[model samples]
Target chain A: MSDIPADLRYTKSHEWVRTEEDGSLTIGITAHAQELLGDLVFVETPEIGAVFAPGDDCTVVESVKAASDVYCPVSGEVTEINEALEDSPQIINEDAYGAGWLFKLQPSDAPEMDELMDADAYQAHVDEEDH
Target chain B: MGNKTPLYAAHVEFDGKMVDFGGWDMPLHYGSQVDEHHVVRQDAGMFDVSHMTVVDLRGAGAKAFLSNLLANDIARLKDAGKAMYSCMLQDDGGVIDDLIVYYMTDDWYRMVVNAATRVKDMAWINKQSAAFDVEVTERPELAMIAVQGPSARERAVPLLPEDLREPSSALKPFFAAENGEWFVGRTGYTGEDGFEVVMPEASAASFWKALFDAGVKPCGLGARDTLRLEAGMNLYGSDMDETISPLEAGLNWTVAWEPAERDFIGRKAIEAQKAEGKARKFVGLILQGRGVIRNHQAVNVGDETGEVTSGGFSPTLQASIAFARVPATIGDECTVDIRGKGVPAKVVRPPFVRNGKSCID
Candidate 1:
């Protein structure tokens, strides 16, 4: 199983959200998500200042053969996106939870985090999908 | 579970991620496909190609039957152990399958065809050989391994049969030397200098282990596809199928049209198509900017629209490249409709990479 930090929250689509001190949210795909899509060759992050609804495709991650979209977990405007992913998208494969964080957002609804699954619940969800 | 190759267990032990390819369960990758691609490009890598079909034909009519059966003339194979790549075409000029046939003798010839087309290939071979004296035999008990890279031949040469080792090591491209059940072909799809070894099924895992110990990394079908794409090799179903003619698929050289006396299955239709003209052209595409190029993308070459038959990110080129069947009037520039965006691409000759070097600027 992939790592699921207890402090963060995750969505069924596999994006993990962590609220910042100033009430903004830091969002990225979970480690489990990166494992499913091997060795990302290209990453297309959402435009800065663009608005997105929950479950919207905010980023496109690609391997050599296939491309997958990264869904947003909460409604927000993309305040920042990981510039490091532009040239070296493999960072997501190396460290999905840390430097591979896709974008920072100012969430419109703070209560959306409650609807997302906790670490234990997300682990169980991943386990159920495995079988 | 699907059809398993003799080396399936070894693939699992080597951390291969198994996926169902056609009807067979095969390795997609051991770990990272990109890493494996680099290994094959720089050092050496081995692939379990045992899932590919192997056929042996014997009898006095072997050469004559193949001359009529394949689009390319096997008469070009004058010497023993010389191999020829040809397309088995339907009577209507459509491709049945692309295969490599090696001339062992006037009475004995060996062929290796794609694994997915085994059933129809066997049925077709049997149906066609009924009029000739050739005995078509499917050798399912044989396993094939492709060890490829600049240094791959030296590493595999030591493990081959002692009697055939020296000769096999010195084999020219598109040639195979054999001893007993072992057939070593100096050919590969990866656009690298390598050896394709065919051996008994029972000894597959052991052979794979020996190569692994010799530092030849095990690569999976994922890396295989990317490698072939970078090399600009045409895949059977993807590049050309039963509905597509080899001429339209950019394989004019593979068709031996000289010597009007040599009549093959698809010769008439092919001639008619050539006379009619306006045939579609097959060419390579290199994406101008970011984003991956994928198959089935509609290509806009000026006013004419075509489609990408095979496309992917080329790890060697660090850019996305594709193969497209376009109108004969296609110029240097084309636009690929990728996810509603018109991504511009350069129309160039096939073979985007070769011999561990990028062929394109």
Candidate 2:
């Protein structure tokens, strides 16, 4: 099983987020998402200052077989995008929760985290999806 | 409930992501598809290609029947262990399916065809064999495993039962030899050295486990696609279907036109097409700029338009590549429409990467 740090929250679409001390959030794909996508070939992310509403398509991840859109878990303004992924996209497959983080965002409201699933809930959600 | 291969339970044990593949519940990946692709390229990887049907053709006139039924002449395979790649075609010169015909003996020819085309191929073969006294026997009780990589031979050779080692080791590319019930072939879809082994259904699980114990990484359909694309091999449905001809699908070389007098099913139609001229030529394209390539995307070549048959990001090249069927007049320069924008590309003959080396100059 992949490491799912208890402090991070997850989206139904398989993105994980950890709130920083500054109240900003760091976002990366979940381990399940990376596994489903196989080998990631290309990634299209939002501009640094771009603003997104809840459920907006903020990023795109592509594998050899298919391309999928990554939606924003909550409304936010993009702060930083992962520079390392430009040359090494496979990091998402290796360390999805840490170094593989896709972007940093200034959330409109941190309270939105309440709507997201915790580790046990996300695990149950993933388990329900398997059948 | 769908049909599962012998490795089905193992896939679940390993947490494989299962999907419906042509009515079979097969693993699409075992957690990381990219890792599997790399494993096959760098070390050894095994695939459960058991979904592909294996048919045993026997009877006195098997050779004569296959020559008339398939586009390629079977007589060329005079050696017992030799194999030939050929296309089973329709009367209109359209490719029905591409397959490998293995010559085990004069009275027996083993054919492995695509999973989706099994029903049609069987019906067509049986219908055509009536005049030549050939029997079509489907080996549903058998399972196949393809173990491929640069180190594949070294890893697999040692695992074989001692009695078959000598003959199996001496087998050349595109050749198969049977020792008892084990059928081992040097042919593979990946652009790597390996063996495709076929054994009885009862023995498949044990053999698979043995290979697994021997350290062969289990791969799935996800890696298989990228590997075959890098190798310049075509997937039957996406590359050429009932509507497409083998000549335009980069498979004309598989057709044999010898004996000047010997006629195959699609000979006359292909000859007419050859006389009239082939309208499209299949070529490989390398993206010059950033972006990914995908199937059915438009390829712009001056005044003509082409279509991408197979395309994806090549992990080896770290760039996007595609196989496209464009106008015969299309030049080396073309543009592939990515999303909404047209991305410039350079047309080159395929096998974009071979033996872990870049094919592009």
Candidate 3:
């Protein structure tokens, strides 16, 4: 089973979000997403200050097996990108939830966060995918 | 559900992430694919290749039968226990499969072919054998294990039967020795010195356990692919199929053209193609920039476009590499389209790495 922190929010596409003190949201793929991808060899982060609508492909994570797109969970402006991943993509495979965060976004619509699934709901979604 | 090998239980016990491989449930990796790849290149690793099809050809006409069947002349394997690599071809010059034929004796020759090509290969072999009085027997009761790397022989030799140790150890490359139920060959796909052991299916588990206990890391299909790719070895489905010819697939050396009177399947078509001199060239590419090269990626060589057959990030070189079929006039410089962006690459001769060392300059 993959780790799903109770305090975070998730999308069916597998990106997890945690609201920062400044009301900006920090986002990264869930552990379950990374596990399914195996060992990550490359990560292409979206440019900072770029705006994206919900369901936009904002990033790409490539493993030895295949490449995957990381979808944006909500309409938002990218405030920061994970520069660490440029040299160390395996951090996502090692600690996907904590230090492996992909980017931070300043949400254009805070109410969209409420529409995302909670930890329990995301866990159920992962279980459905497994079966 | 996919079929399972005799070592399926061992794979599950070792925390293998199982995936369906050519209708067989096999491990894609144990935990980390890169780790397994490094283990095979640096030290020793073992792979359960029991899913590969093993066929034994026996009859007074076995030599004559094989001489006409394979692209490479099996007559070169005059000594017992000698092996020859050849591509079985269709009448249209397309490859049926590439296999290793080992001359065990005057009456018997053993062949190991790709697992995915079992049905077509057997049908073709059987159909061709009718005129030669050769018996085509598929040995499903046997299991195969490949122990590869620099230290592979030292680790595996101790586990063999007492009488076979000396012969197995002294076996030259591309040679095999049979003792009782054990058939050991000093051959591997990893570009490392090692042995490929074929034994009874019932004894596979215990042998695997003994090898594991001797510190041979259990590798999976993922590592096997990367190792082979780095060694410039071709995968049947990815590099070539029924539609591809050996000449266009960088296997020209395997074809024997001497003794013009002797004929083999697909010989006429290949001969015509050779006479025309317009066959495409197969070359290796080293990605000159970021991004991993993948299969089916578009490659631009001058004005003509080509396609990548087999490609990946080579762990040994720590750079992206691939095999591409380009126009015969292609030069050293080319570009590959990765996600719509053209990236620079350099074309070079293959065998990017060999015997734990980089073959590229």
Ranking by lDDT: 3, 1, 2
| lDDT tens per residue, model 1, A1-131 | 68899999999888999988899998888899888888789998999999999888989989865889889898989999899999989898899889999999999887877999999999999999999
TM-score winner between 1 and 2, please give it.
1
Q: Give the TM-score of candidate 1.
A: 0.98
- For model 2, the superposed segments whose C-alpha errors exceed 4 Å read A1-6, A108-128
Tell me the DockQ of each model, to 2 decimals: 0.84, 0.59, 0.72
lDDT of 2 by residue, B1-361 (tens): 7888877888898778899988899988887777898889899999999989999999998988998988999989999989999998899999888999899988989999988788888888888888987888998888899999988888888777777778889999999989757899999998988999988777777777888888899999888998899889999999998888788999988888888788999999988887889999999999998878999999998878999999898877889988999999987799999887899999999888788788889
lDDT of 3 by residue, B12-84 (tens): 9999999999899999999889899999999999999999999999999999999999999988998889999
Estimated TM-score for each candidate = 0.98, 0.93, 0.98
- Whose TM-score is greatest here? 1
- Writing each residue's lDDT as its tens digit, candidate 1 over B1-361 gives 7999999999888889899987998999988999999999999999999999999999999888998999999999998899999999999999999999999888999999999999999999999999999999999999999999988998999988798789987799989999868999999989999999999998888989999999999999989999998898999999999999988898888999987899999999998998898459999999997899899989997888999999898889888999999988998998999888998999999898999999987
Best by lDDT: 3
State, as a TM-score between 0 and 1, how close model 2 is to the true structure. 0.93
Scanning candidate 2 chain B in windows of ten residues, the lowest lDDT window is B157-166
**Residue lDDT tens for model 3, A6-119:** 999999999999998999999999999988988888898999999999999999998889889999999999999989998888899889988899999999999999999999
Of 2 and 3, the candidate ahead on TM-score is 3
